[model samples]
Target: MASNVNIEFRKLFINNEWVDSKSGKTFPVINPSTGESVADIQEADEADVNQAVQAAKKAFERKSTWTQMNASQRGELLIRLAHLIKDNVSIITELNTIDSGKPLTASIGEVLQGVSLLTYYAGLADKINGQTLLSDGPVFSYTRREPIGVCGLIVPWNFPISILCMKIGPALAAGCTLVIKPAEQTPLASLFIASLFKKAEFPAGVVNMVPGYGPTAGAAISNHMDIAKVSFTGSTEVGKLILKASADSNLKKVSLELGGKSPNIIFADADLDYAVEMAHQSIMYHSGQICCAGSRTYVHEDIYEEFVKRSVERAKKRVVGDGFDKKSESGPQVDEDSLKKILDLIESGKKEGAKLHCGGKRMDRSGYFVEPTVFSDVNENMRIGREEIFGPVQSIFKFKTIDEVIEKANNTHYGLAACVFTKDLETSLTVAHAIKAGTIWVNCVNYFSPQQPFGGYKQSGIGRELLVYNKILRLSLLYSLQIKTCKIILYCLTYSMKFCVYEMI
Candidate 1:
């Protein structure tokens, strides 16, 4: 294998060793914050993915220490890794800022979020138990929540570390091995994080990361027959492609946390000042690259002009610059593609007749910067309202009644999250129930913990992550139970007996 690329990172972590890409191709990990190359990583193609999967398959099939170890022991190891992360928090923050071009504060918060997840799952590792159901016959039935073998997880360029922990901690805690495909743009921190696991002395092949493009490497992992589960976090179009790939292969279990154009609604009764502040944060956090960003804002018709003016002033005050800068409120989008997409949307919004309040132009200097832009008089049918821009721009609409606003918000295919700001409990409760998103925040925007589950209701995605209450639907295996003096209702090669049951919600 090639020695560690002194110019950059040399190897992709496979089977506990840093090995060069099978193809011997190398790519630079560019710092979007500075528009400079910071590190180099092996650019793995399909062949590299195959090697990673084979190692993961071997690790799982051999009943490796990761699978056979006691849950408590695994949890303890996870806690150790979490502590390791705590010590190197500043390094992680800097890496994330340089890698994905988001503010260092946001990256630091994400690193902490990841650490908390590891610690939380560490406590939960031994708690994943299968429950027994009271049966009528002399047959005992119970469910087993066993790990589903090698998991192929693909994380996005945004929020790399936190999402990585979300996928890694749960799967490992449940006794599964992994083959991760980090986004090609932002793979540095994950590589370092996985290296920390090596420092913590995890068994070989328990977790392998291959940094490569989505089409070849990611497809190779999804289409691997030995992979029993697939977990992905990305755009809506890509999520569907993953589903198709999973179905084309061994029909592995699939979980997706996809795109969103979430709504933030402000009733006239809301705290005006707080609403204005939240409205600014709803789209500007992480440069509005967040998947659950409240990109679409709705205000009551009575307070529309006031909300717009205050929101515009607040948007104007946002300082945009390099993420490493201490005083920067907003940073550039992740890379060039993200910046271009945001600019295109801004032009389209102006053409579609939505009045640009401020920040319609890109920054004249530096790497991949867009002004925190806002659009007003946005119609529900406009592209700005319907599309997921994934940038530092938000489209605002005005509505009169709670029911009407709910209808407008739910009209989109993406329903990842929604936020409502109101002091009246009755109106909040009524509006919260009606807003058809996976997560609804009352007087808050993007409040997530390691304990609370987050997903979507519509085309936003499939399956959830970080659910505290264990609702795993594990089906019981027949051979493990003892059946005695039970009615054998086997109708082989004939019509089966009819069964019917009624359930209430």
Candidate 2:
């Protein structure tokens, strides 16, 4: 086994120990900005995944110390982890920046988000208690919330630590052990954090991270009967596979935060300046790699042309270069495949008769960089208009009325998130209520809070993450009956069962 200092040869972290894969397989993780290999990460196959799951299961059994620990103790550990992350924010940020090809500032912000989530869940751990029932019965009964055994957490590469905390914080707060499968594209920061878990004195097998591809490690986690639950954040197509795998194995609980082709509706009676600025940031942030990116822009016909012009100018001013560069606002795509996909989508938009406002090609460099592209006169049928480009590309559509825009915006199968830029109270409320999305932002874009429950309606996702409500979902309900004084046994047979249950809205 290699030492923890040598992160380049990063290995799987199972049972609080860094070990090589059973099959001795490893893959190269590339730096998208330079098209160079950042490190060769150890790959975990089904065998490795099973070993990790077994370890986690053992740690989660009824008699294990981890499961028996006090809820407040667990919260203290999470708080310690948060402080550790804050102390080492620079290293984590750099690792994430090079591994995922996102700007340094963005990576730093993501790490801070992770820390905040951890802290939030830490404070919420001891407070996760059931309520008293108001039933009129002589029998005393209450519900107990217990950890849902071992959990399988699968996180994506875009916002690595941010999404990981969304699951890890809550799972830990609920006293559930884990077997995490970090994305192959960006595994550096995850491995580093695994080491932090060790430093924090987290028990062996309580929180394990296995870096590998989705097919093997991810599939094993989803299909493992011992795994009580699986929380996945990735594409919609992959989310389907996970749902099937869970049902096929043990009918384990599944939570999915999947893809989105979200729409940003800009009404005429709104602040055009703020709308244009936010719209640009919505699509161009992280080079449009966000799952809930406002990719499809629906502008009111009254100011559609002007909005498009300003949006294009804003895109042109953004500096695209190395992620570590202080002056660079945007970076390259994750890899060659992502760059190719974005280019292909741009061509399809052009062929489909959408006017290319500017930047319809890749930058002339050795890296996997795509220009910040914009398209106008885009109809619903155009490929770029409906499909998620997942790159720095925007497709603007013109609408005349609120009803028409609402109908068009809600046309896609995805409903992860949507934004409305309007000052009119009636129009904003009506549009916000009418849009079938999990998160509806009025006069803002890409704003997230740990307290707000986020998930999707349709094919976008199945469950939520990063809140006290989500923490409750990671637990199982155990009801116990306490016989108090019974009046008439035969006459009291129709009495309501009084049991305390925690409910979320």
Candidate 3:
């Protein structure tokens, strides 16, 4: 862990105040690099979640400060919070790295991305507009968008700071108060940012943080009756459970950004070196904990052998050590369970007849570290190719033509994202259009922008994140108003309708 990194905010944050959990229980925050306890954070259970939701509900009342604030004012607060995050980038990066086992450089990049999201949403706050309609009657009609009251935001452990900003940016801009539940494994960064919310002068209870296990606090948020909507970023299995909780409770609106097994296709006409490096980084970044990591790579048969050779050498040379080390290219897995699952999946790949080109075993060290592993001769039937292996493990497959590769890429149940690397513009366009993923990167991988919307198709996810102007509208209610200035009544004779005349009064 970094010497300057301090865990200042440990308790639950509700209504702009830090307090202990109702259960008075705490959980250990471990440093993955050394596998030791760094701090014990206050655990939030169902009772704590209730308190947070109540606070948010109060803040969302019609007469509350958050409710009465103008769109520009809300935008200003987001901008202020963004500036505060920028002012303390160093400390926030350190806290994120220490809590999530991500490299310091990557953590810094995520923090800046978060700032960009906040700024983007701030700029869009006052720009949101509704529509006016013309009806067949003598009445004027127009639509007004209003907030949906309290919301529950569930943040995953990976890329904590950035994802938090991604959710809060639009939600706050749309005047929706929130009760946020940061993942238990990595809550320090979220809690630290909660302090900045107060510094930004956001109204009390507008944004709250409650850190605890998924079953307790997370479930409570999904099932809370007062919460009008829930936005979650995590696994597909858990996403289903959250949807069920919504149905079982208040039927709150739910948006999920779930798991993925993204495919990276490299054609023979492409720049082989760039494709190989991008594919490698796509999976190796943050130890491949990202949901949209390109775990499956399909190479043209003409360059398959050479690509595998280079990828294996690259994996072997990757430096796996503490995240704080300047020379380390990769860091430890988030925890022991994650390490074991990755290792188990690696073994399954071997058993399923995939050729292990290089690194396979776990790195013998103090913390939960695994070697960057690569496999070749992969097929769609193998577990490595079928499942979302959220680790630094690459599975490479060979393809003969564009049609076959596209079929292979779309074969997975998950369709979050995909990548195509080729010099031929026609081929690139064809593959990009043919793939069934939400985001298709042409000649690139893992590229993200705040202006672009990101989500998935099939079983990957339900809704998009970023490009939040319309998404924020989805979090609001639409009301149509019609006004009539004059009333006219028509009278008709019933006995002799054929010859009778109608009179207007």
Steric clashes per prediction = 0, 0, 0
Q: Candidates' lDDT values, in order?
A: 0.80, 0.84, 0.84
Candidate 3: clashing pairs of residues: none
After superposing candidate 1 on the true structure, give the runs of residues whose Cα lies further than 4 Å from its correct spot.
Answer: 1-10, 468-474, 478-505
Give lDDT tens digits, candidate 1, residues 293-401: 8899999999999999999999999999887777887787777888888898899999999999999888988678889898999987888889999998878999988
For TM-score, the strongest prediction is 3
What tens digits encode model 3's per-residue C-alpha lDDT throughout 1-505?
Answer: 4647778999999999999999999999988888999899999989999999899988988899988899999999999999999999999988988898777877888888899989999998888777777777887767667666788999999878889999999899888899999988899888999999999999999999999999989998998888888999999999999999999999887888899999988899877777778788889878889898889999999999999999988888888888899888778889999989999999999999999987788888888888899999999998888988789999999999889999889998888988788777778778887888888877656666677687888888777787454444542233543322111111211212221000110
Candidate 1 RMSD computed on C-alpha atoms after optimal superposition onto the true structure: 10.6
Per-prediction CA RMSD (Å): 10.6, 9.7, 13.9
Off by over 4 Å in 3: 474-505
TM-score of 3: 0.93
C-alpha RMSD in Å of predicted model 2 compared with the true structure: 9.7
Given candidate 3, what's the lDDT at residue 482?
A: 34
